[model samples]
Target: MKQNLLGAIYLSLAASMWGGMYVISKYVLDFVPPLTLVWLRYIIAFVVLFAILKWLERKNENRAPIQKRDWFLLVWIGFIGYFASIALQFIGTKLSDAHTGSLITSATPAFIVFFARFLLKEKLTLRKICSVTLATIGVMTVIGWNINVGTYFWGSIILVGAAVTWALLSVYVKIASERFSSLTITTYAVLFALIFTTPFMLWELQSKDITYESSYVILGVLYLGIVSTAAAFFLWNKGLELMDAGIGSLFFFFQPLVGSFLGWLLLHEKLTFHFFIGGALILAGVLIVTLPTKSVENE
Candidate 1:
């Protein structure tokens, strides 16, 4: 019970941080191009994560070496989750509108549910199905029906690919958790992602110049690297380690809700009636999955 609560807290915090990440990324992207910014974020996050991992290793002094298979899994996580999904997301959002990107990628948790069932062999409970449906509806409500589907068909497909890749990342993280600590998994996975993103960053630099003159841009980069990448990734992995991937995935709904709230707060965006209604449904869906029931307890 305590672990479930902790898992929920971790997942919620991670999702909320990612929600704010959009706002920070919006500001930072003006100075840094998409691929370059992703590369920088990974570099900073990897350094921080590596330092902490080393400190923990020293404190423990008896950690086992990671196996070859584990290394492959870690690399897969980095390539698919950090590099590919993020790149696809940026490209898709560039091609489509933000509304289409948000609406489509919001299906990530649903994909996670499917992946969890297939990879982890978790049962597809009625509760999970209903929760995902409710939360998905809430997300559509929050994002609205402002999609330019005919114009952005290819972008939408890429965003779907992004969602699938992210879901695979989540499930793979859970699988890896059986062998390594979440910290170790996150650190090593991010290290590999930094490696994968290097060429893209260099390629992007050939065409674009980064503006480093503004303090706001510097701070935004730092925040994205530290808070959103390092801290949030660790939190998310740790959360998934503690709970069933499907149940933990419902907390992802918090991302859109918090993003909407932050947009209203920081950018002075208007809050519509749909935001509150959708936000409530999202919260309710999370609660339905997270809160213990008699049947779940028996299982």
Candidate 2:
């Protein structure tokens, strides 16, 4: 009840589920187009989560009124958090290497910790600072620190933008939940994402013929929309509302590790020394952030 191990374990598992999502998403591209896959994800999420929450209301433990100010923030969360980030991520992944996309996206936690301090009025600690530093270094290493790879440049930039947007959304959710239910926030976020992406959906339909042209297409859409978008994000915001942003974001570490493994096993990508060493640092950083220190327990 004090946001202890149970809470941490639950949130960590949720994050791990998300970490595994990239592999599923990367696998599903042959069955669905990126934009269409995004659309279906949010649309399905909107319906499923709304209905699930409604049914959950009977538990008499979950329900609330969200104030107008909170509503405004959540709307943006849905738009930016759900729609924009999701769209940009797939777009970036589409154009970039899986390794680059993953490394850049890991910045979500770093953003959360940064924004928590600067925008949400949270205190920073030395251990967290070091974790952030190490994670950043690890991510940069995976990015190759060499800009000459024209193939990965623009895509990496977009992925970085996606990471930033997601971090901002996490901060907004943390602040917004003070006056709103995390359930309401999650539900509304998906609904608003659906609304925001509708224009793109129309344009997509008008111009492109979205076919389940490849098995990759199908897997990408289903996994991203249903599991990653709906379950992962909903749980993420929930965990963030209940705990520190840094702790919540440490869950993101799984994404790159899972992605890298799957890429080598499935995508036939080479597993370089850089990938393993960088991944180890990122994973270690996540554990460092999530584990309770003496200061936390004594407090």
Candidate 3:
């Protein structure tokens, strides 16, 4: 129970941290290219995670061997969580409005619940379903789904793909806990994500037409990699390992609200009133799903 509590706190902190990254990221985008930013961010995150793991190696020295079955799971999570989701998100924000990008990404909890049902065979609880429905309504309100401003070809698809990837990763983590330590799985995932993203990072640096004049870009990269990616994922997976998929995902609903506020506070971005209302609904929906209630019993 103690481990579970720690994990839950870690997950909430991780979720909040990830949510805050948006505000910072929007500021960085002006001076950085998407690919370059991703490259630098991952490099830093990789080093930080490895360093922390190594630093704590003394504690885990007598740890049991990781099961062979879990190795595949870790690699898969690396692909989805760290690389695919992170890269696409960075690119999507760069390609589209940060506001729109966040709205799309907020769809994650809904997707997670869906995937969890089929992939992990998690029971479809009413609270989770209601939470998903409320979040959808909130998202629709947030984005004004009526407003379509983009290449109108593949950009939206790519953004959706990023959300789906993260959702899948969430489900994978839920399933993987049955077989491995949450930290171990997350550790391997980040480690392998770095491995998978490294060559691409190098290749991207070589080929991309990018701006590299400002220190803010470098700072942003370091921040993204070290704080946002490395520390955040570790805590997040730990939380997920400890909590239920529906219950744990309640925190994810906080990302857009945090991101939007950060974008407003730091990036000087404007927020529509509708967005505030949408955000409120999302939170309300998440609450509806995760709250321990007699309503569930009454209904």
Candidate 4:
């Protein structure tokens, strides 16, 4: 019970960081191109995570290094996760509202549940199904039923792409965790992501000039890099290792909650009835997924 509680806290913290990240990324995107910003974020995160890994290794000489076979998995995860998904998120959010990005990516837990079945061979129980269904309904309610495909069509599509890739990353991370430590996986995966993103960052720089509105933009970038990418990623992976992937993924709904709250607070967006209603449903869904019933425990 204590471990599960700790896992919930870690996942919640990670989700909150990512939720608040949209606002920071939106501001920073004014100065930095999407691919360039992603590259820079990974670069900063990689350096910090690598330094920590090195320090830890020095302290504990007995820890085993990652095997040769796992390199491919790490690289693949880096490519799909940080390089593709996060870049899509930046581009999507730049083109759409932060609330839209949060709502759309809120569907990630559903995809995680789906992928978990095949990838992790996790049983698809009725409670898990209902949890995902309820959360998805809540997301739709929060975002509204009206479709404006003519205006932000591509942005919505891109955000969906981001959600799918991120879900894939989560499931794969669980698979990888069976063999590798979370810190090792996160550091190396981010290093590979940085390597993959460099060329794209350079290409983006060819036509785009980065200009900061204020020194505060630097702070935003630092927060995105160190806190969001480095620390939050570690926390998220650690949380996943401590709990079932589906249960762990239920914490993702916290992203939309935090994102919506921050969006209202910082951007002065209105808090409507839908927000409260949807938020409640989302919370209920999370409780359903995380609070293991007698049947779930037996499974």
By lDDT, who's the top model here? 1
Ten residues in a row with the worst lDDT in model 2? Answer: 140-149
Mind giving the per-residue lDDT tens digits that candidate 3 earns over 209-295?
A: 666588877777788888887788877777888777756776776666676677777778789997889888987875675445555
lDDT, candidate 1, 1-299, per-residue tens: 89999999999999999999998998888889989999889999999999999998999978899888789999999999988999899989888989999999999999999999989999888889989999989998888978887899999999999999999999999999999999999999999999999998999899999998779998999899999999999999999999999998999889989999999999999999999889888988888877888776442
Alpha-carbon TM-score of each model against the true structure: 0.98, 0.83, 0.85, 0.92
- Best candidate according to TM-score: 1
RMSD of 2: 3.4
lDDT of 1 at 164: 93
Candidate 4 Cα RMSD after full superposition onto the native fold (Å): 2.2
Candidate order by lDDT, highest to lowest? 1, 4, 3, 2
Root-mean-square deviation of candidate 1: 1.2
- lDDT, candidates in the order shown: 0.92, 0.74, 0.75, 0.85
lDDT tens readout by residue for model 4, 1-299: 78888898999999999889877887898888878888878889999999999998999988877778889999988889878898888778778866677667777898898889888988898888888888778867776766444578789899999999999988888888888889988999999999988998899899998888899888988999999999999989989988778878888887767877898999997888998898898889878877756764643
Which runs of model 4 end up more than 4 angstroms from their true locations? 90-103, 149-158, 295-299
**Once model 4 is optimally superposed onto the true structure by TM-score, how far is the C-alpha of residue 159 displaced, in angstroms?**
3.7
User: What is the C-alpha lDDT profile of model 2 across 1-299, one tens digit per residue?
Assistant: 46745456656666666766656765564545567767888887777788888887878664565567767887888888888887888888778866677667867888888888898788787778877878777766655665433778888889988999989898888887787667778888888888888888888778666666666665566666667767877777778878877656666665566666666787787888887788778777766766666776432
Tell how far residue 159 is off in model 1, in angstroms: 0.4
